[model samples]
Each structure stands twice: as structure tokens, then as C-alpha cells.
Target chain A: MVTRGTTTATAGTTRTAEERARRVAADVPDPELPMLTIDDLGILREVHVDGSGHVDVDITPTYSGCPALEAIRADVLTRLDEHGMPDATVHVVLSPPWTTDRISADGIEKLRRHGIAPPGPAGGAHGDGRAPVPLALTVRCPRCGSPDTRELARFGSTACKALWVCGDCAEPFDHLKAL
Target chain B: MSGDTTSERSGWRSAAEPSVERVRSGARPGDVSGLVEYTLRLGDDALILSQRLGEWITRAPQLEEDVALANIALDLLGQARSLLTYAGEAEGAGRDEDALAYWRDERDFRNVLLVERPNGDFAETMARQLWFTSYQYELYDRLRASADPTLAAVAAKAVKEVAYHRDHAAQWVLRLGDGTDESRRRMQGGLAAVAPYVDELFDPDGVTGGLGAVAVDPAALREPSERHVDGVLDRAGLERPPEPAHVARGGRRGLHTEVMGYLLAEMQHLHRSHEGASW
Candidate 1:
């Protein structure tokens, strides 16, 4: 009677097949943002294995219209298959929904390294859409690290980003919007 | 119950289950009466608006606007897919999102008449967006607490996205309204044109009424939407369109404008023509 909702990845635990499956799934890179893995994006929620070694992997999307979801799903399956689990199941969950804060610190650093601006901390206590206005911090340019930037458009090439240009560096970049 | 639970625990049955079904957790499929109808009303609104927004992909006033509208359309389409898929599951009918979207006739679509209204001009488009997105923002915000887990989850994701959409619309409304005299006139006209359809969005109906806490009463969303939109209008220096004498209704019952037929034809023709062709 294995239950859901348990967190994975502590330094010292009796390693099991489920943990191995988690590592494989977590290593799958995000299709759209290749700099980060699904685990780094915090979409890889839970990976479980039954007694027969059947694997169930749960993931959530950063946004509802995230086009890379199908690719991520296929990639996870393929990675798990390479790890000797061909018949793994991936489920997309929406509860306790995905937020910008879920992007691991390493993922944020990766985005910065890749010339994309990272989002500020999503400070809303509830998913009720009423975000506290004071946290509307400036998005610095990943290139020049300048806080002087202006938005070019609210929407961008992808669903998760907004287009902005740095005033000091005069460089246009994508800022991941805090949802 | 225990026997079914035991079977569900066996792994095979739950492996290929749809996201909506699996995330619904403890709720029984098709348990909520009127759930399908209520879900379709919301789903169809998103679908139709998405189709309308998709029309602006290359045709928007600027290149940035084109990308913005396209991104917004994609988001709405995503929401529609989630909703219509959930609606199909609640119906327990073999229909899926594609079936509901591509197969349904205009008379069968449950979207509000406002969404299917032709995107007349850029100002009109912004006006329409302002009204609809603000309403959706309110709707999804309150709907996060729905008893149905799928609907609640959908609302949780949607509310965040819709806030950005509302900002886009309000930004445009302000730019056009407070700019030139000619631009102000067009924005005013655009607002007045859609005023007739506004009442129907908030009209209390049987589907929402019967669903208890599982559905947020559209009537309850009215005050907040108005408060928010009115603030935008004030800042934009645009007058509130007067309450029209005739309010268009019956969209919840599938009655739509004649233009809906044209919109439906264009949207459904590809799928209807191909029938099951996939890449």
C-alpha cells in the first residue's frame, strides 16, 4: 500500500528501484528550456514503483499551454526506457500547481548563464490570482546585470516568457514570468 | 467500494488514465450532476475566444502584438483543452476535446455570444478582451475553491494566466482611449458595441445553480469584474457604455449569433475534412 505525496532525494535512504527511476526521470531535459531538467523546473513531482517494478511518474506543467509538455512526456518515457523500464507511466498533475518559485536555484543560475532573465520570487500565498503588488521587482539583464530594463511586450516567443530590453546594455532578452 | 478501490490500486487501470481523471483523486467519475453542461460553458468560451485570438496572429497592429495575441491564444486553447477534456470525462460519453471542439455545430457550442462576435477592429478586439479577461479573472479566482478537484486545479492554473491577459487588454484600452481623439471615439464605440452582451456573462443559470459549490455562480463574479473594469475605464478616460435595453442571452443554452456559424465552419472544417488524419 504505497501512498503518494512523499518527497524524494535525501542523502541517506535505502536506495530502491523507485529512487533509480526518479533519477532517470529527473535527468530528462526540458524540451523548450533545454538549460534545465524537468526536476530542476520542479515539474517532476513524484516517481513511484510497485512491487512488480511498474513505474508511475507524476509531473505538472509550468503553464497550461506549455507546448513542450508532450515532448517532455516523451523524453521522460524514453529516458526511463533507456534505464531498462520500457513501460513506465507518466501522469500530469495540476494540484498544488507549478509556480515560478519551483525553478530550482540551480535552474535559475542555468537560465542566467544561458542569457535569459530569471523571474523574481512568486510571493502570492494563494493561487487565487491576486498577487501582492509590492513584489513586482525589476528584471535585470542577464548580460550586463543592469536593473534598468523596459518591457517590449507582455507576451513573448514562448508562453512562459515576456520580451524585454535592457536600457544600459541595449540587449533584448526573455524574462520568465512569475505565475 | 473497497473492491473497486482495490482494482484501482492494481496499477493497470490507473496507468493510462487522463490527467483530469487521475488528479480528480477521490471523486467518482460523472458524480456531479450538471457538471458537463457547466464545464462546457466555460470550455467553449475559452475555445471560441482562442479561435478568435488566433485570427490576430499575423494581423495584429504590431509584430509584438501579434506574438502576444498568439501566446494568449495558445494559453486559452490550453485552458479549453483541459476543460473540454474534463467535460467529456464528466459526461462519461466517448467524446474527447477534439470531438467536442471540431465535431460540434454552432448550435451545440455553449460559448457566450460575446466571444463569437467578430473581431471588428484592433480597438474592438481590445475592448472585447478587456471585458472577457476581467470576467475570467474573477471567475477563475473564485472557482479555485470548487469542490471538483479537476475544476479547482484548472482554476488555479487559469487564474494566474488570465491576470496577464487582463493586463494586456487594459493596457491596450488605455493606450487607444487616452491617445488621439479618433482613437478615443473608436474605443468608445467598441465598448458600447459589446455592452449588450455583458449581462449574459453574469446571468444566473440552471447549470451553475444546480452544481452547488462545485460551480461558482456567474452572478457572484459581476461586482468584482465591474469594479476592476470601471477602474480601467476611468484611467483610460472612457465612459461606461450605458446599460443597453436589449441584452443578448441564450448562449448558455447554445443559441449564438449568425456569425458563429462562419466561425464554426472555419474552425471545424480542417478536422471535419481530415476526420482523423494526424501527422
Candidate 2:
């Protein structure tokens, strides 16, 4: 039996097909929102292998109407196919909607590096200078390490984000909303 | 001992509460016509406005702004789909989202005149967005507590989305109004052209009264909507136009502006031709 939740695959270990497929899929990143991996966004639901060595991946959209879904599907197919999993199917699920709480800690770091702030915690506003915000306070400037940032527009380049301008660095960036 | 155990089981079973079958039923036709009509009206407003916003996809002045407008349009389209689908199911007409969207003629659409207006320029689009989203946000807020559970659910979801839309438009309105002289002039002109249509959004038709308990009275939406609009105007340093005398009417009953037919043709062309095609 494969050890669940183990970060590393042991040397000389015989891994199950499902585990191998998942390890391979770890490389698939979100196409439009490149900062977060599909798994980190909570879009990647499951990865499984069939008797014929085909892979099936389930994904859920953040919102029912996102156009990026089509692009994401195509990207998944391309990535998996190139990884030698030629027969792969990407299934889109609608139940149990995607939420910001699903984003992993590593995903937040990736977003910060990409010039966008990861979503703050579930229901608190950003930087009102209140109690240490539970949902990750301190939106560091993607350009410079400055916490002095203000919202420019609640809607940003995409539906999932809002525009923010760093007062110190004078650069604008996107803040992923805590949906 | 076995006999005693069986007797105890029987006694407990008899004492337990009877199973109640509570089925989730769709909205009834006549009972929810007003509510259905109201939902369709809201859906049409979003659909038409979404189409107008979509035109800016590749044509926006900047690449980022282009993506922004397209994203906003996508959100509106999503809201429209849910609202329209719910409305069709409630109508009990065997209609679905596509049927209602593609099969309906121009006169069948119930959107406000304001949303049907053309997106002339960036200024015009921003003016329209400011007016319409402000109105929609207020409308959704009240509708969240609607008697109909489905309507309430839809409103609760949409309220969060529209809040963002309103904020985005509000920022642009202020920027344009406070910017260069030319920008201010264009903004003023855009606002003037769209202001007359706002009157109809507040006007109540007879359908709202008929669906009394099941509907949000359109008349009731007037005061709060006006207050919201006034707040946006104040922040933008713009004055509200004197309410227009002749309110545009008949959209609820299928009478529509000249542009409706063209819009329908484009929106429905594919579905009408193929009958059933899935992406």
C-alpha cells in the first residue's frame, strides 16, 4: 500500500498508477493565473488511472461562468500528454464550489513572487489595521518590499482579483479576492 | 431474551416520528409569473449589458483594460444564465436557458431601456456601467431576502459579484469626470444620453402587484435605488438629470426598442440553426 500524504516517494518504491499520475500532474500550473498550481487553486479535484494506463483528472471552476476554464482544460491536456500520459481526460465538476481557503501556503508564496497578492483569509477586509488579520495580512509589494498598498479598483485584469497600487514602490498589482 | 428484544424494537419503531417526505418543488407558473417576469427582466438587463461590454474585448484602449472589461462581461453573463434558467423553470413553460435566450424575439425581452443602449465609447460604457450596476447592486441587496428561496439564493450569490462591478465602474466614472476637460465633456455627454432611460427602472407595472407575496414590488425598489445612484453622482461630481417625463415602457410585455431584434439574431443564431449543440 502507498503511504498517503507523504511528500516524497521512497527510492526503490513501487508506486501505484494513481500516485504516479498525481506526482506527474504536480507540474501542471494554472494557465491564466500562472502563480497558483491547479492543485493549490482547489481546481484539481482528483487524478486517477484506468486499466488502459489512461489518466483522468477532475477540476472544478472557481465560478460557474469563468472563461478561463476552457484554456485550463486545454493546458491540462497538453501538459499531461507531453508527460507521456497520452490518454488523459479532464473532467469539470460544479458541485462544492472553489473557495480561497483551498489555496495552499506554497501557492500564496508563488503568487507573491508573481507580483500578485494571494487572497487574504476567508471573511476579513485587508489592512484596516485591525487585529492580526486571520486571512494573511501584509500584502507585500511585488516590486518592492512595501506594505503601503491601496486598492485601485475592486475589479482587476480578471474577475478573481482586484487592482492595488503600492504607495512606496508606485507599482500596481492584482490582489486575489478571498472568495 | 430474544422475544423481549424484538418487542423492544417494535415499540421503539412505533414511538419514532413518522418519516416526512418534503420534496423540493419548482416554482408554480401563475403563482410566480411576476417573480419569473422580474427575474427575466433582471437577466435581460445583464445579458444586454454583457453583450455591450463584450464589444470592448479587443477594442479597449489598453490591454489590461480590455481584459478587465471582458472579465466583467463574463461575470454578468454568468449571472444572466442562472437568473434566466431559474425564471424559465418557474414559468413552467418547458423553457430552458437557451430556449429563453435564443427562441425569444426582440419584443419578448424585458430588459430596461438603459442597458439596451449602444456602447458608443469608453466614456459611454463607463457611464452605463455606473448607472446600471449601482441600480443592480441595490436591487440584489433587497432581493436577497425575497420570499422565494431560489430567488434569494441567486441574489445572495449575485450581490457579491455586482458589488465589485459597481466599485469598478464607480472608480472609472470619478476618474473621467475629474480628468481632462475633453474627458469630462465626453463623460457628461454619455451620462446625459443614458439618464432618460433610468426612469423606467423605477416604474412599476401591473405584473408586480399580481405576484404580490411572491415578488419584490418594483415600486418598492425606487427609493433605495435612487439613493444609491445619488451617492455615486455625488462622488463623481456630477448632477442627476431631472427625471424624464415620458418613461419608456412595454418591455415586460415584449415590446422592445429597434436594436433588440438585431441583438437576438446574433445571440440566437447558432442555437436556432443547430437545434442542440454542446461545446
State the TM-score of the second chain for every model. 0.91, 0.85
DockQ of 1: 0.40
Best by DockQ: 1
Worst 10 residues of 2 chain B by lDDT: B12-21
Residues B1-279, candidate 1, lDDT per residue (tens digit)?
656333223211111365444434555333454888889999999999999999998899899999999988998988898888888766766678889999988788899999999998999989999999989998998888887767887888788888889889998999999999999999999999899988889999777888888889999889999998999999999999888889998788888988998999999898999997666
What is candidate 1's lDDT per residue for A20-114, written digit by digit as tens? 99999999999888989999999897787875678888788777878788788889999999989887888776766688889999999999999
Docking class of 2: incorrect
Q: Candidate 2 on B1-279: residue-level lDDT in tens?
A: 656332222210000111011002433334556767888988888888888788888898777678778878888887787677767765766677777888888877888877877788888888888878777877776766666555554565566667667767877888888888888888888877787777777777777667555556666767876776678778878767666666676666677788777777777899889987767
Residue-level error in angstroms, candidate 1, position B208: 0.9
* Per-model TM-score versus the true fold: 0.91, 0.71
> Model 2: which residue pairs collide?
A121-A135, B107-B254
Expressed between 0 and 1, the share of native interface contacts present in candidate 2 is: 0.16
Native-referenced DockQ of model 2: 0.11
Q: Candidate 2, residues A67-166: lDDT per residue as tens digits?
A: 6777777788887787777888776543233567778888888888888888777653311212121333577677787889887656576778878889
